[model samples]
Target: MSICKIYFSLFLVSSFLTFLLSIYFLILDFSLIIELNLLEFNSSSLVMSILFDWISLLFMSFVLFISSMVIFYSEEYMAGDIYLSRFILLVVMFVFSMMLLIISPNLISILLGWDGLGLVSYCLVIYYQNAKSFNAGMLTALSNRIGDVALLMCIAWMMNYGSWNYIYYLEFMKFDWIMGLISYLVVLAALTKSAQIPFSAWLPAAMAAPTPVSALVHSSTLVTAGVYLLIRFNFSFSENLMILLLFISSLTMFMSGLGANFEFDLKKIIALSTLSQLGLMLSILSLGDYYLAFFHLLIHALFKALLFMCAGSIIHNLGNCQDIRFMGGLINQMPLTCSFFNICNFSLCGVPFFSGFYSKDLIVEVMSMGILNVYIYLVFYLSIGLTVCYSFRLSYYTMTGDFNYLGLNSLSEYSFIMLKGMGGLILFVIFSGSLLMWLVFPVPFFVCLPFFLKLMALLMVSLGIWLGYCMAKLKLNYNLSSLDYLTLSSFLGSMWNLPIISGLGVNYYPIYSGEIYTKIFDQGWTEYYGGQNLGKNLSKFSKFLQLLSNNHLKVYFMLMVGWIFFLVLNIY
Candidate 1:
């Protein structure tokens, strides 16, 4: 077997073993902490530690499982690449880094894993060696670097306690004034990793990576690292900070949903959806329901991974065409692929009985019951509705509408290895919600609300479907290409110009400043003063000295006689 295959098999086996161990821990309600002193000073020590509990174990299992399937999928998807082994090695290292983050209780150790994620993800993003990939990789790395710096600041702030293990200090630090800075930094770090709001540009741009990397990094493990961090540090947040987090997260959710509705590229649309779901997770976490946030995070990982896989299968067969405008009636040609796609879409919409329903529905219901601001309530519900809106819109454009492709396309499930990889997650997409709910929540959530509020989610879903169908039908029937219509279309279609705002808006000034600096300091002033002018002056002085030293003995004698004459004059 090839090394990739060997690693894939090994990962699969490890996933199963980890899942079993997770179940064992859940049954026993067990936890373990292991610590070793690495180095000691007078009053401080560098220590490495691991915290093994239900949460970490369960999360680790899911990470391993998803990674194994992604590796299996990539075997076919990345088949012809010369650096396939290197790619596989990078993925394995990514998993190992994630495991380190999952198990570590100390902030110092977490930095190791955290930096590893950022570095590895950058490598993965630029794997294709294209200009687009290079730009996306830089965006990915630099955005995450913000969080890395924030975490470093957090570690420095944490030194006030003389220990780097945050778990031990969360309760005591909850009311500490110093914790305000730490909490802010923590939330900032989480926001960056989760791609919330201002940090969102990189998430969609990162679609330049291979599909399997998208499935593993963007969908499941890497993005959720922020949500996981907040879950761990939930106690350290004050009420005001939580509210601020809620506001940002809700806005992020609504913004992504709005952007997804306007998007046409297949992978970018899904990437936007992932952003929206991340917003949802963060909002729930901000609401202080850490368990529900974690629940939805895991469930989202499953369906989103499947969703990306289905999209990958379609793109693979369509000769890399990702524009949904050029796609239609794929369901007729690729029945199984469309079926998986639709199921994953509906799951994302939180249709009843699907994996998302168990977590998302509960999150909405709980939000409804809470005494939240009216705007928060509206944003949450409206974002939920928009999820269905864009989902149905996507389905309409890609699956049921008239055939839109210009040329003959082979939309079939010929990639059996990819299908097999997706098949592994399909079952979980259908049932993981219930399975996780049963395992994680021993006590059921108690939700009491008015009938209309209870039906609000369903009502929005129905409305979204109707609107999507109407919009698709209208496009087919009429020429809606007036200037005004086109303007509005562009606005909504471009994610409210978030790509411009976050991508170009945030970058333009710095890039402009860099240009100025390069011209003035690097190429202009520094060259003249530091390099060219200094060299010219030194060369002129050397020439003058050489002229005075002329290689003849007569020249030397003349200089000595001149010096003696000047000395005699001075003496006289």
Candidate 2:
């Protein structure tokens, strides 16, 4: 209790201060890079760079803010856990790492935070210490290591400029192949970290973590780190890379949204929604509307954290049951949590005047007006519908019906401490969109599109709400449409077989060949010709030497006979 209180106070105070500072910096249109030379050896200057731009400070504030809420919530949610202190420490470490990432513009410094996120996140994902958590943690870690390697390559690529501070060279890397290489590496790093497309399986898989950790990770810290990195380096992307990012992020957006609609796990549904939003951020960033992307990102952090918090509350009330299929009519029992959940869902669906609308509606308009092909346009809007489709489906399945899943007592709404933490952010989730929009952009983004194009956002949202209601309206006796088209449902539900692809498809051959190589080399021919054969030969030689040393009859006889035969042959 004392530890949680202490950290919560620290994070909360820091968040308020940084958020105020971000506002100050934004009004001044100012950015300051504080460079402390950690080491200056010859041509290489290793500097600990702290960037205090509006973006970094603002994002840092959000990270700290959400982290405080999560820690506060975990106090109640994780109340009886023996290692609560340890869990709190891991969360603090995660927030600290994210802060480090937020403030650093240097690639080397970023890696310190980048690698910290991977290591600490893996620890969080496996906090339960169960087989499922263990597997999720492994997948999360290995998948992120790919990004770690890519960031290392970015560092290496930046070495050509005689400095690791890539911020000083964003434009330089744009036209030149040397710098373009860094951009490619950065994109790859971001893709893996953000869980886009092929690397996406880890995001949902990481639901094995506690809900508080999920609130921190899937919302504000680890997943958004990639989006933040790309936001900083948005200027460096080449035309070809931008196009490719659009396609991949669009698909990731669609795939995750589709997966969520088919998913039954409450936490996984939220996780998948996060995946979809990440793709949205990346997609808009690719469209060269990074300000709006960052806006959506901040707004997303607010609600997604709350979404996970509410999900955690429900899951706790259900006695750790995460299936939405078993949940119904929770609104009467858990009215506050249900209200927060649906508000977040409405925000997620970009309902008018809500926090999500200010950012998301703007992004949709911008994308609609941007120079893009028909395929991208379609995927973009379809992903939006799928997002709402899943959110409403999740709401319907969990909140609309009776509390008959576990028992009446299991679904009580008495956890005020948890609700207290959630209350701190609920107002922000509702109004931060308009509030931040007014602050972040002095003059609004004016996009000129046709009447029908403007209607698309609403149309898709309405369609999604209708479809979600229809889908979740199924009775226990109703056969799931998902069950009818098992193959397609499985494909979509499994993230288009990405987990299998990134898991088995990626692992099978290397493991298979590794086993073969192990047998043929380490355990077979190499063993025969290297260590074992050498040992056998050495043993034989040692025995022969022992016979000579022992003055054995056969050894002595052979030696004496050979000496005599040599002497006789020399005389002849």
Candidate 3:
């Protein structure tokens, strides 16, 4: 077997082992915390610790399982590449980094994993070695770097606690002023990592990566890291901070949903949907249900991974075309791929009995019961509706609509290896939510909601479907060129100009400042006074000294006599 295959099999075996271990921990309600002293000095020591509770174990198992499947999927998707082994190695390193992040309870050790994730993900993002990948990789790295720096500041603030293990200090430091600042910084880090609100541009741009990388990134490891961090640190947040987080997350959810509704790129649409789901997870976490957030995160990972894989299959068969406008009637041509795509889409929309329903329905009900502002309530519900809206729109544009491709296309289930990888996650997409709900929430949720509120989910979904169908059925010749419509479409289609804001708007000032610095300091003052001028003066002085040395003997004797006379005069 090839090395990739060998590694894939090994990871699959490990995932099974980890799953078994997680189940044991879950059933017994047992946790094991291990701390090893990596460095020791007077009154201080650098320590590494791992927390192996059911949460960590289960999360680790899911991450490993998904990673294994992605590796398998890439075997076919990434075939014919000369650096296939290197790609697999980088992926393995990514999995290892995620495991490190999952298990570590100490902030110091967590930085190792966190930085590893950023660095490795940058490598993966730029794997294709193209200008688009390069730009996207830079955006991805630099955006996540904000979180990295925030985490570093957090570590500095955490030094006041005499230990770097945050789990031990969350309660005691909750009310401390320093801890409050740390909490804010923690939220900032989480926001950036989760691609919430202003930090969301990078997520869509990162779709320049290969589809397998997109599946892994969007599903399990990179984006969910922030949610996992907040889950681990839920005890440290104050009510005011939670309120702030709630508002920001709600806005992010609404924004991404709105953006997804107008998006056309197949992968970017899914990427935006991932952003919206992340916003949902963060909002729930802010509402003080870390378990629900984690549940949704896990469930989202399953369906979203399958969704991306199916998209990849379609794109592969469509000769690398990702524009949904050029795709239509694929359901008749690729029935299996379309079926998987529809199932995943329905799961994403939270249709009853699907994996998303168990988590999403409960989330909406819980939010309804909570003491929240009307705007937040509206945004959440509308965002939910928009999810269905875009899903149906995407389905119409790509699946059941007229065949719009200009040339003959081969749409079939020829890539069985890719299908097998997707098949592994399809099973989980259908049942993981129910399974996780049973395992995580032994006590059921008590939801006392009114009829209208209870039916709100279904109502929005129905409305979304109707709107999507109407929009899709509109004639191609219909003119949408009016200023008002164009304005609204541009705003929504450009993700409310978030890409511009985060991409160009944020970088404009810094880049301008850098140019000014180069002109004033590097080329002007530094070059004149510190470099070129100094060198020029030194050269003149050296030339004068050489001239003096080349003087004739009479001139040298006269100079010696003058010096002797001056010395005698000084002595007198």
lDDT of each: 0.87, 0.89, 0.88
Worst-scoring 10-residue span by lDDT in model 3: 475-484
The TM-scores, one per candidate, come to 0.90, 0.92, 0.91
Q: Candidate 3, residues 1-572: lDDT per residue as tens digits?
A: 98767877888888888888988998999989898888999998877899999888888888888888889999998897989999999999988999999999888778888899899999999988999899899999999999999999999999988888888888887888988998888888888889997898999999988899899999999999999999998898999999999988889899888877777789999999999999999899999999899999889999998899999999988889998888999988888889999999999999999999999999999999994889888998899899998899899999886789866666678899998998888889998889888888988899999899999999998988987777667623322223343477667767778777887788899999999999988898888988889999999999988887788776879989999999999999
Better of 1 and 3 by lDDT: 3
Q: lDDT value for candidate 2?
A: 0.89
Lowest summed lDDT across 10 adjacent residues in model 2 is found at: 475-484
Give a tens-digit lDDT track for model 2, residues 321-368: 887878888898889999999999999999999899998889988988
lDDT of 1 by residue, 1-572 (tens): 98767877888888788788888998999998899888999998777999999899888888888888889899998888999999999999998989999999989888898899999999999999999999999989999999999999999999999888899988887899888889899999999999987788899889998998999986667898888999998989999999999988899899888877766789988998898898899898888899999899888988898889888888888888898888898988888889889999989999999999999999999999985889999998889888898898889899876788866655677789998999888999999999999998988888899999999999988987887776656553222223343465666656556667876778899999999998987789888998789999999999988887776687878889999999999999
**What ranking emerges by lDDT with the best candidate at the front?**
2, 3, 1
Q: Is candidate 2 or candidate 3 better by lDDT?
A: 2
TM-score of 2: 0.92
Candidate 1 ranges with C-alpha deviation above 4 Å: 37-46, 474-491, 514-545, 551-572
Q: Estimate the overall C-alpha local distance difference test score of candidate 1.
A: 0.87
